[model samples]
Every structure is written in C-alpha cells, then in structure tokens.
Target: MTLSLTAQDKNTLRTAAYGAVSLIAAADATGSPHKIATHGSIALASATGPVGHVLAEKSKIAGLDGKTVAELADHVLPALTAAMNLLREQDPAQAETFRSTVGIALDAGVGARKGEPGPALTEMRRKISTALDAA
Candidate 1:
C-alpha cells in the first residue's frame, strides 16, 4: 500500500526537526539551559549548522518526500547513525549528553502532545542512545 504526507504534514515534521536542531545548537553555544557540549564545544556548535542543513535538504529529497513517518524514519536512520558514531568518537561523554538532552527536548515537545500517531520520540532516543553506547 502507498503512503503519503500532505504538504502541511511535511512542513510540520520539518519544523519539529529543525526546532530540535536549533535548540541543540543554542544550548551548545550558550550552555545556559541544556549545556549539551562536546570535547570541542566550539566545534560542536559549528558542526550543527551543517547537520541541520543536511537534514533539511535530505528530508525534502525525491524519495523521502511524501513518505509516511515510519518510512521517513527509516530513510533518516543512516544519517542519524553516522552522526551518533561521529559524536561518540569525538567525545563519548558528550555523545551521551547529546542523547539525554535530545530525549529531554523530545519529551517536552513531542511527548507532551496527545494522540500523535507516529514513532515515539522516546523510542527514537533509545535507538540513538543504544547506537551511541554500542559505539
């Protein structure tokens, strides 16, 4: 069976994803609220820009456009895996911090909303943490 997302749905997903990236970036930069940092905290701040750009660009690619949530998750998994791997190699502690901070954000942002039909952010965070831990 074919699955699709309306333009509004895609825009919503993009906004949420970008918002998460922005929150991370801001936290890494100022270290006030979340304080999520890497060994090279300055570098981490720089890295997030490209990561955010890539996520925005890739999500709108032909194959990913109109995909269901699960399908979109599958498509993005490799990028997420690669990112977690890179972070772990750079700073294991910071990688763990990344996962935790992301989890916290997702809990507040996505988890708080009732009746959302898709993969739980908690589950997604678990997968990311597991991957980082294994690495």
Candidate 2:
C-alpha cells in the first residue's frame, strides 16, 4: 500500500521511533546506556515497510534533547501517540508495523542489560508501552 506522509509527519515518526530508544537508554542508569542505545537504534533501523523507510532517514529528530528523562518523555510520548494515530488513519497495518518496530527497539534496549531490568528501566518500559497503546 502507498502511504502518504508529510515532512512533519515523517518528523513525528522519526522522533517517536528514535526517541523511544533514547528513553530506554536513559532508563538504564547502571547498565551501558550506549550499548542499549546502539542495540535499540539498530532495531529501529532494521524496521521494514514504509515505517522503516521513514525511520531510516538521517534527518534530525528535534525535541529529543531534553536533559531530564521526564522532559524527554514530555516530547516523545505524545509523538508516539501522534505517529500511531496518523498511520492508523491511513493504514492500520502500517500502524501495527510502526508499533512493532518501536516495541522491538524497546526490547533490544531492555535486553541489553545483563539480568532483569531494574525498576526504573521496567517502569520506563511500562510508560513507553502505555504511550504506544494509547493510540
């Protein structure tokens, strides 16, 4: 299916996808944040379909520079909902792909840890999942 997304829409998608990785990475207080980010980003980059193409773009995802995790969430969570809503409007299947892509990225980040994720990591994951499901 041909998907139509504006530049702003693309920005929202990129921000939501990449921002999710950043969120999970930030949640890893003790573990290797960089490693989590790397794995999560790779998962996002590996996404398929139109969602993959949009996320694979190198364009800047602004508003992800918040110093605090809360600040970052303020910017990202809404984008997640927005991106999902936009895609589902055009194509539900593509929306599912986008959701799966983001979920996998989160898993990659969380899985980077040696053992079970810490409380913060788990909570942050819950928040991200809640945001994704909000749409």
Candidate 3:
C-alpha cells in the first residue's frame, strides 16, 4: 500500500521533528551549560510554539510524559522514522524536503546550543535519510 501524506501531515511531521530536537536540547541543557541560545530558540519557536509547548504536544502524541530526554527520544525517534517512511512512499520530493529541513533545523538547534548533538539526534537524522534511500 502506498502511504500518502497531505500538507497537514507534513506540517505535523515538521512540528514533531522540531519538538523532538527541542526536547533533546532541553534535556542536554539541564546538565550542560550550553543551551539553544537566541537563534535556536527563534528557529524552534517559529515552527512550533515555545520549547515547553512542543515537548508537551509531542509527549501527548507519544502517550508519555517525556520528563527525561531518554523517554522523549524513545518516543520521538520511532514516530519520526515511521513518518519519514510514509512520506517517502507517498511523495519522494516531499520526503527529501522534510529530511533536509529537519536536518537543517536540528543543526541550528545544536548550533544555538554551541555543542555537538548526541548520538540520538544523529541516529534520527540517519534514520530519516535512510528511509528515503530505502524507498
């Protein structure tokens, strides 16, 4: 079966991706001095709401509180992967665009924090790209 995504679906996925990255950054910020700073905050906020709203929305979708980074990642990654797969099957161009946009967003998020992304974010990026390749 071909899985198709409407514009709304793409928007949801985009929002979710931003939320996921924000969730990870917030978690990292707790322990590290580096935070998303001004640019990252603006980037994320422009897409979704504040970081807290994104986390809450994603958490509600994942059916988890997402109190910790691990918990959030566990839920967000799988959802994102699935969404990518569906988008790839329905519209390859859109899938590519999503992947690129998410990658750029993630990078901006990390750059704002002035630190490297952890393994989870990297893995999610890889998974999104791989889904497109596999399709």
Cα lDDT computed for each candidate against the true fold: 0.39, 0.91, 0.52
| Candidate 2 stretches greater than 4 Å from native | none
The better-scoring model by lDDT among 1 and 3 is: 3
Question: Of models 1 and 2, which has the larger lDDT?
Answer: 2
Model 3, 4-105: lDDT tens digits are: 456545445644565555554655554332354344435544543222233233323332357766666566666566656766667665555555555566
Of 2 and 3, the candidate ranking higher by lDDT: 2
Model 1 lDDT, full chain set: 0.39
Model 1 spans > 4 angstroms off? 1-66, 115-134
What 10-residue stretch in candidate 2 is worst by lDDT? Answer: 108-117
lDDT of 1 by residue, 15-129 (tens): 3333343333332232322322221232223333323332334444332332344554444444344445555655555445555544454444433234442434445555544
Model 1 pairs whose backbones collide: none
TM-score of 1: 0.41
Ranked by TM-score, the better of candidates 1 and 2 is 2
- Worst lDDT window (10 residues) for model 3? 48-57
Predicted model with the maximum TM-score: 2
lDDT per residue, candidate 2, 18-126, as tens digits?
9999998998868888989999999999987799999999987899899999999999999999999999999999999999999999898888778888899889888
